[model samples]
Target: MTAPAKTYTLLDAAGRPYRSTTKGLWGGHRGSRIYGRLDCPTALLALARSTGYAHRRVFFTDEATAAAAGFRPCGACCKDRYRTWKTAQENGERWNP
Candidate 1:
């Protein structure tokens, strides 16, 4: 018997669809890669936004690991959003995380 294809909720700069690996410690390029220059948390947030994930925590990990898990640099794709998130990280801001 064969196992089903493992799928990941990956996204691209323009908020498009693609698949990532079910494996860990991923870096540079994969076979017929789907997502383009997007990261995990950012992808998750984007997915939540478009597909209505409606979860509490967008990602439950540190920035680096979260990114390594497939999250893109929020500073890039989500610039304004990143700035806002950064501010929220500091001091007391409404809409925590």
Candidate 2:
């Protein structure tokens, strides 16, 4: 008999584990310490333009997890949000958005 299928699990923003049936939930860049929506056009364009882009692509279960990992919002797609976060950092305020 065939063995039961194994389920994939990922960490939440709080680092809790949860089952993930499908991938491609969120995208991140390890080099830049940034993350954004999977459908972000800027991220898609960057991925298309680079040869080793796939290696830099990281996935997160949710935005909270991405933020918790110290990933800032993408500047391209999340322009306003990025600006706010940057401003907060510049003013020495804790960023939480």
lDDT of each: 0.40, 0.78
Model 1, span 29-84: residue lDDT tens: 22212122335465455556754433322322123443333433345454664576
lDDT of 2 at 42: 84
| Alpha-carbon runs more than 4 Å astray in model 2 | 1-19, 22-24
Q: Distance from true position, residue 67, model 1, in Å?
A: 10
* Global Cα RMSD, each model: 12.1, 3.4
What would the per-residue lDDT of candidate 2 be over residues 1-97, giving only the tens digit for each residue? 9987666555467544467765646788878878888888988988899968767777787776788878899988888879998999999997877
Every model's TM-score? 0.27, 0.74
For residue 73, give model 1's deviation from the true position in Å.
5.6
Clashes of each: 7, 1
